[model samples]
Target chain A: MSSATTFLLTTIMISFIINIAISLYGVFAKPSLVKKFIALTIFSDSVNSFAILIGFRRTPLGYPSIAVMPSPPQSVEDLKRFVSEAVDPVPQALVLTAVVIGLAVNMFLVGLIMLYYKYYGSTSTRRVKI
Target chain B: MSTLQDPLTGIAPLYLIAVAFLTAALGLVIRSNKFFKVFAIVNTAIVFAISAYIMHKVVDEGIQLYFFGGYPAPLGIAYEIDNLNALLGLLATSIMLLSGIYSAWYMNFPRTYLYYTLFLTLLAGSLGCLYTGDYFNFFVMLEVLSLSSYSLVAYFRDSPKSIEAAIRFAFTGIISSSFYLLSAFVAYASFGTLTMADIALKARDLNAVTQFSGGVVGNVAIASAMMIALASWTWTFKAAIFPNYFWLPDAVPEAPTPISAVFVGVIDLIGVYGAIRMFYTFFGQGSIALQFRSYTLEIFQILGAISVFIGVFLLLLQEDVKKFIAYSTISHLGLIFMALSLDSGEGISAAILHTISNSFAESLLFYSAGIAIVAVGRSINTLGVLRKYRVALAGIIIAMLNLIGVPPLLGFWSKYLIFKAFLDTGKIYGVVILVLATGISAIGYFKMLFSTLKPVEKIREDPRLRNSMLADITIALCVVILIAIGALYMLSPSARKFINEIGYNVIEGYKAYYAFLSSGS
Candidate 1:
């Protein structure tokens, strides 16, 4: 709603898009398995950040907001007002799970790469054929 | 009706998942192959029993909803079971049971405990995916299934090819799942809820409000389409549909045979189920769906047509038996997709029947192929070596016929229903494509049979074929079921009624689902 908030959101959006583009290029273009894994990690992190961005909210006072459990309010009216100011928490929670799953996948990829290197003496996918 | 007091609602679905995880932990602690084998079989059998009971309860008492930790549907995770999920749950558990039995004698890896643990975990994750009613929970379960499958594919760590296949599968699978997560995020942002029923309700409300106010609902429509597109990409990838099927043939053939059975038979079906559930239950009646339904169906039809032709052509070229079976699976999955894309009750029923029958046939094919491969040595890819093994060859022929949709087999009835669905819709192009694909697929199967059954001058008896009673029994059981189901269909009216009931339950069950959720029951 405000210029500062709009600018911040725009910057985050642009950075996230650029991160995804570069990571996707790396994943598809890189011949080495390790590079692809790194690219995938970056890609997943960008997705998580993008998800968090969707949950962002701006208050009437032109400040960024987050959803938190409000401590006791003075009245029901006060509680209603506070609730309207809070950002969505669902996407943030989803991002948390995504990050953990991403870590598990990345760790598994790293182990697979290690095994690949040990077996074929190279980490390049081009060199490994079934 | 009082919701929280109903003990049977929540506990039935959780039993399988809990038992699986408990057995997995026990496998880790004990590290004994015999102990884990027995544990896995017992747990899968129990899950199968529970699944059958849950199916009966669901059909008798209506849909069962399970909220976690006493929390309600919108706020906490829930598992919803209608006839559709109950049927799928039953199928998955039964396949896991058979696969477990087959693995007991088939799997000879040094790390048997780890294998059983991962196997059981995979089954649990699949069952969880089938049972869960929440979007985020479904994604988590999918990840569980994918991770376990990747590990299982690379189970033969000593073989470079298996590990290579696993690497490719894991990367592609992870990318697909990331897309799914992104779609879930979009859906949540649009609807502010992850529960499928709640989302459907809010989506309808949003559509109504936007239409009344003459506001810009284009953004909402675009978001819904984007979500569907993203999720469909993941599903098509997992189901080995057109343009995303490169990993399957490589991944499936390299896994151990029992794991291959699970991959081709059970895991891929879950992918199809996800697509159907998302499209039919969550988005079926929404405004966006109403706008995009025909377009989506067209896209699926085209893709399905491509997958069928390409799969059969590739199947005709494969020298390896496992790869051939994998290609056949892709072809059959394409047919299932086409049937589902018809978006009719008849279409859905046809797809479901095809799914069940195909699982049995494909798994039996894989098992028989594994036995034959063992008898001839793994390197002997040609079918000439199969001449000595008469029983395995017979099993393979029958299974292949089931796959080719020979009359009186279970496959024929399902295919006939799919064709009838096409005909009812007046989609002559779909009917033509289905007929052509079936013909080409039959040719491929005939080629395989001829190669295996042709007379050879000398037959060398392999010692490995001498003591293959486990595989023989497994194949025989599958064959018996395949023929028995076909015979029942031809003889009994109740069999047809049962299938139609499930069809109605899935196609017409969404309204009841939404109403129940809205009432907070």
Candidate 2:
């Protein structure tokens, strides 16, 4: 609702949009197999960014709380009481799981790509299906 | 206090999942010795018992929810159970236990041990997905299921085709997970919670942030929701529902026969379950006024319909038994999706029932096809003979009949229900599409059957082919279990009520779900 919170939200959304476009471009245009993997990484990063953005919060002093332990409030007048409510921990947990799974998928593919190179001596998927 | 939770029969879904998880962990460490098979079988047996316990609870006590660490509703993670999931959990465990037994007879020791571990892991992930109450946990559990499937697909890493299939599967898995996570994030941000009950509670109060007159949050909300839908679209592909289905038959065949059976039979069933859970539990029923109506529901319906048509059409073109069955899966899944999009109680119930029946039929088809291959010592097209291989051919015939939805088989009831649901809803066009699809499926199945049945003029007995006693027994058991269900369906109203009671409220909440989603509108 405030100007600063809106600004931070816009920044996160823009980054996410850019990452999505990059992944789309890779999916549609990239010829090399490894490039597609790189593109997938970029795509995953954007999703992770989206998760982080959901947890972004601002302090009562009108600045974004970069990171802090959400503490017990001393008084009702404490700005920290109003503004410093901890960001949703669920997204953080979700993103962590996604990153680990992403790593496993990447490892599997890298192994496959190496095998593909040995068999065909190329990384392009164009001729492989036929 | 622990006794109050009812330990033995009123077993939690998590305990069964933990049994699977711990079994997989144990197998990984001790896989070098012959003891691996014994341990794996024992582990699966334990999981089977746990699933049976959950099933008994559902049949007797109704849906059960367990919060980890004893946190109450709306605050802690909950494993909610009803008949739909209890049945699926039981079905998965039974199939896994049977397949584990069958694998010992049919599979080599080394591959058997490796696959058993991965198989249990995949089963755990699927069971977790079925029972979890939180939206984010659904996505996480889905990833656990998908990731294991990717590994299982690539288990035959020595083969290029298998590797390629695994890669594509992983790519699609990533896409689906992203879409699912994105959807969860948007729903959470908008509603300030991830629990389904809370989301439903909160959905009624919030309005879409409107800078102007229309209820749009500018570019922010649109992108978030689109990302979520895109993830689900990837699932549509993974489930082999028409256009995105090039991977199922090709990659699946390259895996060993038992693994292929689980992939098509159980794993794909889990994918369909994920879609239903997302649509009904997360998004509520189909409401056009909800944001992204055209993209989520309409586009999904069109995709589902196209998959039904194309799947059957493609099946009509395939002569190979496995490939034909693969296409049959796409067509059947299309019908399921059609029901899902319709979002009626009957439609959802029919889809759930159809899911189990299709899984049973697919397992029979794949296992039978494997046996046929072994007995003939060649592919179906290359093999010439029906009378020469009567038992294997009979297995194929029974499987084909079920796949084609011949009356009194497992497939027939589900098809009847799906068509009836469409007819009841006055979706005459949907019924027509289903009828036409079934017709084409019948032709496709018959073509494969006819190829297998072609008589050989001079039959040469091959000793190697005759040694497939284990494969024959496995197929016979699958057929018998399927037959047992047909009579059971005829004999019980309480049995029918068990399934309805579990999935009914999830479907009934559609109106409230839509209200929550459109409150801002």
Candidate 3:
């Protein structure tokens, strides 16, 4: 790999790892349910970015394509060139699905938190015994 | 085009999935309780029929691969139905049908139309998980299963305990699902394909090339191992294995009883099926298994043994009857895992049989316990209060006996098969540990059973049990099925032979699976 590619990969990896660490700390160590929900969102989003990063590929011109096909290449030569240059599309599709599922889970958690507060008159889970 | 017109191969699984999803969507708009109840029953019955037909097709004609929209395997999603999944799909749909009928009386809360909708969605998600051949589709279906289950667990939102359990369940569930997604990303990054059969083919080719160089101890090997480990962790969490099992006891008991039955009977079993499918079908070939087979088997073996011990130990201490049954589920699942870990034809057969028996037994137990709870005026802290309901008490006894593997019940034959598999593998330690676990669990089950049978001086009449005709019919249906299976096993050699064939099919289907992927038709 080139120096620019190595640098880009290293940066993405480090950011994903750091975000995951901090978010996990919030989810497990924090007592507040709302904080845990926020932390969960961060964790999910970071994982989604990691998936997208795996699909990232640098072209010969040193530009990264996001793997969304504009249209199928009509010519065989163009198809071969596109296949070599384009980023993998599968992980990008997976990330799209993950993002939507994450949003739904987050919304459900918020509703549950609201209900928990209404019932127990508190949002902190530390006092709630398992 | 004419080949694609084959009904059993092309549209059977889709019919099973679409019926549930459409019923759920229609239930939401209709908003009538009576209509929702009837719709859920009729819908699950249709799904059950389709599942049975698909299983019959798979047995007679062989593996059925249904590609959605007429797209082939690599380019579009497909539903791969072999004997293993066909049987599991049938088991899951049958339980859903019975529980859907029982829930007509069990779910007496206001706005029960929403319950029916969620119930159907959960069934659809499970059927999708069983049928999908694409890894990304599996992840999406898993999310659908988890989200609907989390909502169902908190359906009785009036109780603070139920909400608490739901939160914990959701938190653990999302974290585990993220691990699954991460594993998918790693697999796709390495293989450049999302279809399981294609991935398996590539992995096998890589293994063939690497075998001469050395065993697969390179970077690719490490990546594949990591993917398997991560995926296994997510599956174990869902299956409620030892370390990841804390949420199960809390979550299952808090849900309404019919939902509890779904959790233990359908959802947890699907989790085990996913793990088994991943190990046997997706990663059965190539460097991944070659490098990590022994280690993976040992990990599952030890984990399964520990879960068996801890689950039964916890069962002995539970005051609440629902929680007791939940812990028993964990213990039985551990046995199934132990069998699956052997990774042989006999072991897989044992696991499948146990899955069948345990699904029916656990659902029967939970529904019967639900009846006792209703008869005892909602909260059943002690078993003494159940003396008033003789009919439910008898059902509970039969169910408990089946769970304990007493003779002449379906559970006994499955447990016998598992023991035989352990002995066949020469895992003496596994056999000894399972025997000890079964012995201890029998004590706990008998204690719960006998207490329910004890007579009380003041026999109070419960209005709920007095009118629970539907629930009675459901429980009776489960008991009859259990007995019938047991009798068929004893009386017929062909029935036993058929189950063995299903097991061998799972073990031998890998070549055909790879052939289809490589053919690229």
Task: Tell me the TM-score of each prediction against the true structure.
Answer: 0.93, 0.86, 0.93
Write one digit per residue (lDDT tens) for candidate 1, span B160-180: 888899998998899899989
Off by more than 4 A, model 3: A65-75, B1-31, B207-218, B285-287, B377-390, B456-463
TM-score of chain A of each: 0.86, 0.78, 0.85
Where does model 2 exceed 4 Å of error?
A: A1-8, A66-88, B1-3, B6-34, B109-111, B204-228, B285-295, B375-378, B382-391, B455-469, B498-503, B509-521
Supply candidate 3's per-residue lDDT for B41.
90
User: What is the per-residue lDDT of model 1 for residues A1-130, given as tens digits with 9 covering 90 to 100?
Assistant: 4987888888988998899889988887899998999899998988888888776666777886554545676788777777668776678888888888878888888999999999888898776542
DockQ of 2: 0.60
Clashing pairs in 1: none
| Model 3: residue A121 alpha-carbon error in angstroms | 2.4
Give model 1's TM-score versus the native structure: 0.93
Question: Residue B141 of candidate 3: its Cα lDDT?
Answer: 86
Q: In CAPRI terms, where does candidate 1 land? A: medium
lDDT scores in order: 0.80, 0.68, 0.80
Model 2 compared with the native: what TM-score? Answer: 0.86
Which scores higher on TM-score, 2 or 3?
3
- Over the stretch B261-320, how does candidate 3's per-residue lDDT look in tens digits? 999999988778987777777677443555585588789998999999988998888878
Alpha carbon lDDT at B443, candidate 2: 75
